[model samples]
Target: MAEWEDGFWSSKDGLRLHYRDYPAKAGSTRPPIICLPGLTRNARDFAPLADRLAGDWRLIVVELRGRGDSERAKDPLSYVPVTYLEDVTALIAEAGLDRFVLFGTSLGGILSMLISATMPGRVAGLLLNDIGPAIDPAGLVRIRGYVGRGGSYPTWLHAARSLAEVHAVAYPDYTLDDWLGMAKRLYRLTPAGRIVADYDSAIAEPFKVPGNESAGDLWPLAEALKPIPALLVRGGLSDIVSAGTADRMQAELPLLERVDLPRIGHAPTLFEPECEAAIDRLLARVGRAG
Candidate 1:
């Protein structure tokens, strides 16, 4: 098992955020990997993947504000992507990272594009997990239905079962143990012994605003990764990233590497063999290969 260090950095607005930093194997010089999790997700979501990749490259899995052990935003509106971009930038500076490969899932993927656009060439490579330039409305609607609905469970098993009911569609193959593992990542056991969602319900406020779902043209942001080595991983059963949108992204970024997981929906766990291979290929393309 790889050893990891706990990290904390102050956001621009003074919130103390957290991240887990896993070092590369002894004497290795591979470029570091900074992972960003999906909306409503925290750094724990990347633990399994980070453990697998840490031997090849340093991995920093960040807990976006209001998630995990991080401080909640003073203003709920601060949960927006633009604000997240600022926080990510601060993290990069705090970590003294001049360059790194980005592994982003969903909302994290969107942030990767925005960051690349603003700081072109800083991202050595990108791995976008189940997100595209164009988001489907149906997916947003489905997400809105459950994103902010926080609940408390009497036991971890109950919480796991409840979560499985909501996300089983995305991981139809997951077993009871898999659901339990996922529950641990997505929920926290409170001091009162109740298991609750890890992220702030307030984080969902922006999505509720009128026209916020389709507010911006992300294609421009997506294009920012065009010159950098990139990989796009999509779930074939995904509602968030349709096959058509993924095709269009490939057409737009001619260099983009792609992997489509037929059994998953919304996103594929980055620990999968295919995803790991894709990451290796992207790293090679960007000259970060071991």
Candidate 2:
């Protein structure tokens, strides 16, 4: 693991979001890469990649609000992507990075697309990991199922098992310990010794307010990001990003480079050799494509 250190980012609402610092090699002038974790995930998700990328670029992994060490919002409604988008912009400025690259996964991608469109100049390039404009209702529901639910498991091991039971199909490469680590990262130990979900569950409640309605029409967001150097890394077996959507994205934005990772779904964890290779290729392209 990278030498992890704590970071705090104050949102406009006065909420201080938590983050981890992964410093790159000395004298490394590579443009910073801001990593955005998936729903209910934290900075730990990027440790594997952050360690590898240390020689090339600095990685700022954010915990977002209500996830990791970040404080939970009293109002769950404050947990939506809009809140996160604002937090991201604040962190970028706080980091003194007027512009940087974005490596966004799942929810992070949604936030990235929003930011790239809203604050185009701040984004040098975008790395979308295993997500796209079109998402399946089934995948969204499955993700929502666990977003803020703190299940009654006596031990963390049980929670890990619960995750394995639910997500094993999507992440076959993860061992039980890996699943346990994932569970641990996603949940914090409460004073009562029970697992309370780390993220603000209320952030996801809006999606449930209306049946079958997406958080918003993200396609317009994608379309608005025209001519920006972008790489959409899709998993071949991903149910969330249908093949048609990927094709449509390519058609709409010819500059968007699409790479499909075989034997993966929803998202690639970015720990595998194949995934790493794809990212390396993207990095080279990003540096030159600009």
Candidate 3:
């Protein structure tokens, strides 16, 4: 297994944030990849991807405030995308990243688009996993139904079974072991010895406010990818990113490559062989662009 150093940085508001820093191979000149996870996910979500690609290019898997080892926000409303952008900006400066690639999943993908737009010429390559400017309403409804509903399980198997029950539609092919792995990634053992979701449940407060459920008008932000090397990974069964949205994105960004994982749902693990191959191709393009 590839090793990584635990990294910590302070957000603008003095909240402590965490990330995993994986070193690049000796003599490697490829731009480092900054990974951002989904709304409810943490840095552990990217462990598999980092294990595979870290040696070729450095990978910084970030744990946004209120998730994983990061400090929870004192104000629940601070859990907005704008706030996350600020946190990522701090990470960029703290890491002294001049130029880098972004590998964003879901909410992370939205952040990648925002970063590209706000910091032009800094993002060399973009990889958006299972997200687009316009999200499907069905997906939004499904997500809203469970965002802040916290649960506790007495054992890891119990937690895994619970997740399988709730998310079976999104991952129909997942075996018990797969669900167990996902449970570990998404939950943590508490001091009392019960398993619970790793993120701050209050992070869902923003969703309570009407019209804040989704980021409004991301198409302009998506436009930022037009001049850069980009890749979009969409799950064919995804309720979040529809086929139409992915097609529109491709039409808008002629340089963007779109990969559809037929067996997947709202998100591709990026551990999928097809996703890995597509990412390799995108990095090759980035290398040639240099």
Candidate 4:
């Protein structure tokens, strides 16, 4: 396994957040990748992918506020993307990083666009996994149903089984070991030996409010990445990003490269061969290769 160290930085709002920093091979000069996970996901979501790339380039996987080891916001309303962008900027400053590539999944992908828009030249490259300017309403509805629904299980096996029941559609070929790995990524064991979702249930408050999901189109923010090296990875079975939207995105940003994982849904785990190949191409565009 690739080695990594725990890192912490404070958000502008004084929230202490956590991240995992994996160093590159000695003397390697490739630009680092700052991974941002999906809503309700944390740094652990990138473990498999990070380990795969750590030998060639540095990796910094962050746990957004209210998720994983990061401090939970006292106010559930603080879970919005704007605050997340602020926290990311703070991370850049605290980490003393000049420029880095971005690897974001779902909500993290949305944040990548916004951050790129705000600071165009600072992002050397962008990889948006299973998200785009347009999000399918059906997927939003499905995700909303479970994002904040927390549960406790008697053992790790039970937690893994529960997770598989909820997400089996996305990974039909997943074996027991696969489900077990996913359980570790999404849940944590408490001192009392109860296994529960790692994120704060309050993180779902924004989805409950009216008009929040369709506030506006993200195309404008995504447009900011036009001048930078970028790639979009979509799950062939994903409902979050429809074929129509992906087609339109390519039309708008002709320079944007793309990949589709046929067996995955909602999101493509970056560990997939196709996703990894696309990432290599994206990094090569920025003069970094694995």
Candidate 5:
């Protein structure tokens, strides 16, 4: 098992945030890789990937406020992406990270772009998993349908079944065992012994406001990635980042390395063999650039 230390830091507004700090191997000079998960996900989502890459390069897997061991925000409305950017900015300063690679999935990918745009030269490389500047409306509608709703399951099996019902389209090859493992990552045991979604349901409140569904004019943000070594992993079955959008992203950012996972859905687990290889290639390019 890859070992990591549980780390905590305070957000600018005083919310206690958490992350898993996996140190690099002794004497390694590789830039640390900072990971950010999807909107409803937490640091646990990166455990498998961390297990594979931890010692070669430092890994910082963050849990945004209201998710994982992080303190819930007093005001649910604070769950917006800009607020998340503020929290991550504080973390960068707290960890004293001068330059690093960004690995973001969905919402995390958006954050990575924002960080690179704002910080300019600090980001060494980027790995955007299953997201782009243009998000499909169908995907947005599907996500909104479940984001804030709450549910409790009597057992892990039940929870897995529930998720399989909703997401099987995205992971058609997932076995019962696979679903079970995913359930553990996505839900947590309650004091009452019931299994429930790990995040605060109120994180979904912002989606309720009209016109917030679209992320609005992100093409300019994509420009920030043009000069850096970047990788885009797109699931062929993904409803979020369509083929058209991915093509445009590559056309605009000529240096991007694009990998299409035909069997996957909205996001690639990064555990996939193809994803692992692509990431290694991107990091090598970063190493050469440095």
Candidate 6:
């Protein structure tokens, strides 16, 4: 049940944003699920999940700026989540979609929550893969180290191998090719011909700068999805979104249902039968209303 899914458009900044969609190919029944990938991820990562769910709800995955086949921004500051929301709004309009479901993971989840708050009317429902309002500082530091690292990897194999270790909690079984595909989507071949990461290197500017002392809070955004049907899926061992926070989220918004996958961390890849079935239930619950 892991397999198929494209909608490609140029952003206002002139970077091509690659979106892979299942569309309403034959079933003209419902709007599609807009798949928002994680940081350093591309649309292709959703291929397996998209193909598996095509028989039910349609799936559309977007390659965010500086990731996947999408072009990197000239202004590194543009890589922020706020910029991402505007870009997604553009894509939604370009797709000719008035309203649709949002399936977001990690960074994508953050954007989904924000968009749900800013453009509630546009999102039919919000599917959060493995993220929440409170993020673990330890995990943020880990991510910062890699995203902020410099220099080219000797080869894709080396890069992939390194990720498998660093991401062992989230991607324990990822194959060499899986890692390679990941590397491809997150980086592009530089003009000098070497494979540099798919970002303006400068994109990490704000993130690297000295901390603006404020406890980050996304509950406002998460709570905004309250009226709209929503589902939160978390990995059991995830450092990013712990069970404690997920529980608190459920309590705050009783309407927002929650589930946790065992033995995974950061995010679940969403290819397992249990995970798939759980998602289908959530989508059906929301999609059936419209």
Candidate ranking under lDDT, highest first, comes to: 5, 3, 4, 1, 2, 6
Candidate 6 weakest lDDT stretch, 10 residues: 206-215
Q: Which residues of candidate 4, in runs, are more than 4 Å off?
A: 288-290
By TM-score, how accurate is candidate 2? 0.89
lDDT of 6 by residue, 20-125 (tens): 7675557566777889988777776677787677756677788888776677787876777878988998888887887888889898998888888888677887
Write the residue-wise lDDT of candidate 1 on 186-284 in tens digits.
999999999999999999899878778753668877667778888999998898988898999999897799899988898788888888888778888
Q: Kindly indicate the candidate among 3 and 4 with the higher TM-score.
A: 3
Record all residue pairs in model 6 with backbone atoms less than 3 Å apart, i.e. clashing.
3-48, 7-19, 68-185, 187-198
- How would you encode candidate 3's per-residue C-alpha lDDT over 72-142 as one tens digit per residue? 99999999999999999999998899999999999999999999999999999999999989888889888
Instruction: Give candidate 5 misplaced runs (Cα > 4 Å).
Output: none
Highest-TM-score candidate: 5
**1-290 per-residue lDDT for model 5 (tens digits):** 79999999999889989999999989988889999999889888999999998998999999999999999999988998899999999999999999999999999999999999999999999999999998999998999988879999999999999999999999999999999999999899999999999999999998988878788778899778899899999999999999999999999997799999997998788989999999989999999988
Candidate 3's C-alpha runs over 4 A off are: none
Which of 1 and 2 is ahead in TM-score? 1
Q: How do the predictions measure up, each by TM-score?
A: 0.95, 0.89, 0.98, 0.95, 0.98, 0.85
CA-lDDT, candidates in order: 0.87, 0.79, 0.92, 0.88, 0.93, 0.76
Q: Give the per-residue lDDT digits (tens) of candidate 4, residues 36-92.
A: 999989888999988888978899999999999999998889999989999998999
Best-to-worst order by TM-score is 5, 3, 4, 1, 2, 6
lDDT of 1: 0.87
Off by over 4 Å in 1: 288-290
Residue-wise lDDT of candidate 2 within 1-290, one digit each (tens)? 56866889788888878988878789866678889998878887888898788767888898888887888776776777878888888888888986678899988988888888888666777888877777877787777676656556768988888888877778777788888877777666778888756666666666666543465568888766676777888888786888898899888876678888877777788876877787887778667855
